[model samples]
Target chain A: MPTLIRAEGLTKYYRRPRRYEGAFGGLRTLITRQYDEVRAVDGVDFTVSDGELVGYLGPNGAGKSTTIKMMTGVLVPTGGLIEVDGTAPWRDREKNAMHIGVVFGQRSQLWWDLPLVDSFTLLGKMYRMSEADYRRRLDGFIDLLDLGPFLDRPVRQLSLGQRMRGDLAAAMLHEPSILYLDEPTIGLDAVARDRMRDFIAEMNRESGTTIVLTTHDLVDVEALCNRVVFIDKGRVLYDGSVVDLKATYAPHRTLVVQLASGFTAARAAELLGPEVPGDVIADEGPTLRIRFEANRISAQEIISAVTSRCPVTDLSLVEPELEDVMRTLYGNRTIAV
Target chain B: MNAGQATCSDGPLRNLPAYLQIVRGRLRIAMTYRQNALFMLAVVILQIFILRKVWTALYGEAGVVNGVALADVLVYLTIANLQSWAMQDLAVGSYLYSLVREGRIAFDILRPAGFVPQMLAHLVGGTLSMVLFATAALPLVALVGTLGPPASSAAFGYWLLSLFFAFGISMLLNLIVGLGAFWTTEIGAFGMLFTLVSQFLAGALIPLYFFPDWLRTVAELLPFQATTFTPVAMYGGQLAGSEAVQAIGIQLLWIVLLAGAVRLIWSRALHRIVVQGG
Candidate 1:
């Protein structure tokens, strides 16, 4: 796939007036010429190809939204080269806007006082969409996203979930080739979140719409993104497959077993012998928790070895949580993965 | 996909229809609050009553003051007040300020249409609705005060042309003030100051004819007078023939200058946002 978005050494710096505190601070700040500089996005480089749903993952204040803003043509980079669909976004904003759809989770682009459908109609006109095309797309979105119930209701009156759905439909109504979703699932409930994820996945699958989603929710990344680009402190930390990220950051899997009354964890460990590579710990009464790397020793081998030696009432395998893996990644910036 | 692929050309003329739709949308939203229009009409009517009483009392036993007839002065005051009430749209400034404050300007920046054009459309749409409400108050205006025809057909034609320029000048001025939000982030004080200064100087509260020679000269020198006084005076026959044409010409010049200022300030504002992450 060809690269649809690219950033090379992209940087954005903000210079804010130095804020003072305590007595006479406001007066001093008013007259002061000094400014403090913040590097919002520092030397970031990444590429997103066509037809790829890449998760632009970051923690709070990680410059994820800043990067997205620059990509969406709302902000001009202070330094370095960035392009969307072969055009410098800030230089040609309207042209860039025509081929891309953007949704910021914190704000809705819909007109506040008008019925939800009115925003669509206005956007259709703004985008210069043909009447037939607009109607067909609107009907399809209404069916797919279940927007019919509140289509005529004012946008300000809709629930958060309903409004978010409306926003999603609005963004995609023009059928842009690329969609940038900044924290799209920020405040959604389980059912709404699931529906959102499903819709995003379907859009990527059916229309081949390249999506760059920035989210704190690991589930959204796990459910929709095949490739993930992790950034923190205004720099790209890791860019690769989610499975590989987990393997690199968190390699261990745990096998939990509940032994029969007569069997103890010690006895189970002894029976497994040194051939099976793993550590078995005594859990709550008559239970053993075995930790092992899948590459070094498979969970099946360990479970079979333990079951053959000692009678087990129940057993389960626990894979590492992506959230924990991300925590570890965010906690230690020095870990080169 | 074809819709997405449609090439967007940049220019006001090409996007006129889209901008008109935006204007229509804003007008519809403003009309949603029907009570607000009625309230405005009531306020204007009450204001007219007070003004008529004051002017009548002041004109006591004098059919004319400063060579201007009482009837013409009443007509001028009525039209001036109505124009002031109808075109009183600080929406552009307040809207820009709030959108910037809440960081919701990203939506504006992301539209295929230019931000300034969209905002101008909004300003016009809001003013159009107010003009509608003002039209509804016309009957009351006639009953409460003098509402006479223009001095002549020529005068009426010049007044119409001058009013168009007045609208342009006012909207552009509001836009310039609104762009201040990009720098200050709070335009409430600025907007209030603009309203007070423009309303007083534009002859909305008091006609330029009432001002002393020095004060009238000062008001005439400024663009505010072009927004209200020029059109009102022409309609009242206070300015006629060459004088009326010159006043309209002055309004056109102000529009040109104010439009240039708006463009310059708008570009700078965009630069500020781009650099500062607005």
Candidate 2:
């Protein structure tokens, strides 16, 4: 299989100053310059194929940015191998840059003072784009991003949403095959986030533009990603389908049962205990709620068994989401990556 | 994607147009304020007119000082001021330093635009401010000024050549400083020292003739003097006949040397560009 990106035994370490708190600490450390080493990205191996949209998730300070930097060839790894579009990214940067587009949520790639069209026109020259191709891609971006109305306005004057849209267009102007977006939808309102998600999904679908996204917004992953990689403390804990993740970590499928008989909470717990090692979440008069690992047994088996033994009136199976899965996987440090 | 032209042996040349495109985009942003351009023109004229009155007084005591006539000095000031106007933040080190400080330079590394060219485009964006101001100021100063003897065509030609060379050398020097951001923790010490040497050696403060003969000889050999002295001397008609022609040749040599130095520094600097700040 042809892979768009691959990493093997990737690790990144940084030496940083450890300044003591309080005034005059700077003066005290001025002569010595005391420092400590930090390992942001530890050894890990992963790969993403062309047309793959992967969710790269991690807790804050989990070395997400470090790994990203190594992938982008912004920082040479302290150890290991990284290849993007079949090239050693750091060793041959100028060649690699031609095939990738990057957008950072906190920093804009567009010229702040220039009108959107002016920025686009200049980008055409920067990338050595053919006039016809530049025009074609430009028209596509303007239409895709709905930038016609804002084309003439200076970027500094754009609203946050408008600027992000313009920035997205600017990032795509060069027609790069792979798009690396770091927190692309950060700080956006619900409507804007949804709009951004729709635009990204459309792009990935239409062009097969391989996308690797790192975001705090779970919705960004749910809306677009079929596969996700979970990282913590600079190590990859999980790399698989999103569906499998929910089925694995978030195993406790909720069974919201509409009870027919008015049974006491103690009586329900006793009855449910014999069938499964599950918790009785609630017993409100005639209603009963039970939970069990979806991975350990089939939902159908549990439902049929419960109905056969007890007077079960109604029940519904609920699929756990990424939020619940992440809580379970990361909540306890007992399991290490 | 072109099969016949697949890689570095071919594509960098193809990519050159992208750099030019970025510069054009910045130039458009510089054009928005017609009122500001007009306003800047008026202010430059007023400042130059006031300075002329001071020069007119100093000339009363002597026809010339150090062979620089009062009228010549005013012209020199105008050119020197323009040199300042033409200044571009030439350091790649500052960007690297800020990236290290903010830890954001990592983001730039992942993109296809190389750090150096990406930043060069940013520098060109700011050039608009100074270029606009300088362009507005120069013409008006010519209209109102007490006449120095007109610059000979050779002098004017050399002056234009020096302007181009000055830009190259200045960018080269600043680029070295910018690259310094990777190793040096503080830019102030080097910045102050570099500025002092540039001011005295480049002849921005006064003509190089006023320096001791030995010092002037040393300054002439160094590339720094070419930034200001070559242009001012040529524009002020300080050099004449073959001397003027030789000066242009020297300035071109300096430009070549500085550009070569910058290319060497860029290669070394890339190895040290630590972007994923802890």
Deviating ranges (above 4 Å) for candidate 1: A262-283, A308-311, A333-337, B1-12, B60-63, B274-278
In candidate 1, how many clashes are counted? 0
Tell me how candidate 2 scores on lDDT: 0.73
Put down candidate 2 lDDT per residue, B188-225, tens digits, no spaces: 77876886787668876556877899999989888777
- Candidate 1 per-residue lDDT, tens place, A221-257, comes to 9999889999888899999999999898888898989
lDDT of 1 at A115: 94
Worst 10 residues of 2 chain A by lDDT: A260-269
Scanning candidate 1 chain B in windows of ten residues, the lowest lDDT window is: B1-10
Q: What share of the true interface contacts does each candidate keep?
A: 0.49, 0.47
- Each model's TM-score for chain A is 0.93, 0.90
- Using DockQ as the measure, which candidate wins? 1
| True interface contacts retained by model 2 | 0.47
